[model samples]
Target: KSKVSVIETWLRKHRLLYVGATRHPFIHSIRDGSVDVSSFKRWLEQDYIFVRAFVPFVATVLLKAWKESFDATDMDVILSGMASLNDEFAWFNKEASKWGVSLTNVAPQKANLDYCRFLESLMSSEVEYTVAITAFWAIETVYQDSFAHCLEDGSNTPEELRDTCQRWGNDGFGQYCHALQSIAEHHLEKASDDVRKRTEAAVLDVLEYEVAFWNMSQGDT
Candidate 1:
């Protein structure tokens, strides 16, 4: 796509979250040739990756359900802003529909103490909250494509289809798992070693199980 097309599409997907006041300091900077498109694109790309990686991890670890919807916070609004831009994203909606899956919600749940502790630790600080919220925005916008799909030629049976969906979901969950690990690592300079190690293990366990689950599918058929 042309740069204009890309920009237009991005705008459509994220216009809702854009600061609209032309007189705003940031807006003025951008309009006055200070902030450039490259800088803006960098931020957009980082937010996209963070959300894609973390959202599912939060859902699986915290919510325990694969197909959950998140609350419409500013994060959700940002995601909607980016998704509004192009017809290509419609394919994601269709693919998800095939398995009747959606993004997981970020609400409280009684999964496990370790999981709860990890989440609480992240949210306890305002800095971590900002990181997580930015990550969530990217996920709300574009993380559905990380997982692989079953062959579309109908060579697989319904049972195979279910297994494929499970495997794919696990793959997506693994990305989220990595996000947790990355965040813990990023914050470790401030956290105790014991706390850091424990948190890292908790996140790694989730990712490890997901890898095992996906690999196990290979042996099934």
Candidate 2:
């Protein structure tokens, strides 16, 4: 299964943990149906925004890295990749703009420093949803506690930040999905079967790690 599917399965199977009386009561209410899941749906929408904001930045960095790794003479491959990546980014940019988000220069703000750090931590290791809602919880906490400050002083509003976080999370997820799809497409072609399987498995492993990281009921890492 794709990482997204695996993560979704984990979310459905797990009971997220919360801390303190406030958290306990909030969790109870949600689990007991007093709070409902409408807000969760909206929060989930933020995932797309996150993907829209950072994918281009990442693609650009990757292109440069690829250039450094290969010869400058391989301009054709680099150009083709750039073209494909540009098309993808353009599509995401249009989507983000419709959501009132632009990725032109979304520098990492002070408030988002922790968010970035936490994401880096996850990316550095092979941990799964054991982190639970480390990313989500961080964004939610920021939203509930410091969103106003972010809106007044940051590049995007509190809603935008939350949306962006979710989008990034989803993009990580989409990467795994895309990798798997690529593997499957190649599998049908009977070319480099071993490489395709390795790529698919690697993406699945990443997806598993993400799922484990997000499934933590204990709240922030």
On the 0 to 100 scale, the lDDT of residue 53 in model 2 is 37
Distance (Å) between predicted and true CA of 8, model 2? 17
For candidate 1, give the lDDT of residue 220: 18
Residue 12 Cα positional deviation in candidate 2, in Å, after optimal superposition: 18
What's the lDDT of the predicted structure labeled candidate 2? Answer: 0.35
Candidate 1 lDDT over 1-221, as tens digits, reads 53442223433644433222112332233333353433333323332333343444443323311122233233333343334323323534454455454423322222223333443444433323323433332332222222222222332324423332343234544455344333323344455556544544433333332233222222211
lDDT of 2 at 198: 43
Per-residue lDDT tens digits of candidate 2, residues 52-140?
43344334434433433333433343244345445655655665565565555544333234333444544332422212112322222
- Specify the poorest-scoring 10-residue window by lDDT in model 1: 60-69
- The parts of candidate 2 lying over 4 Å away from their true place are 1-188, 216-221
Best by lDDT: 2
lDDT of 1 at 197: 46
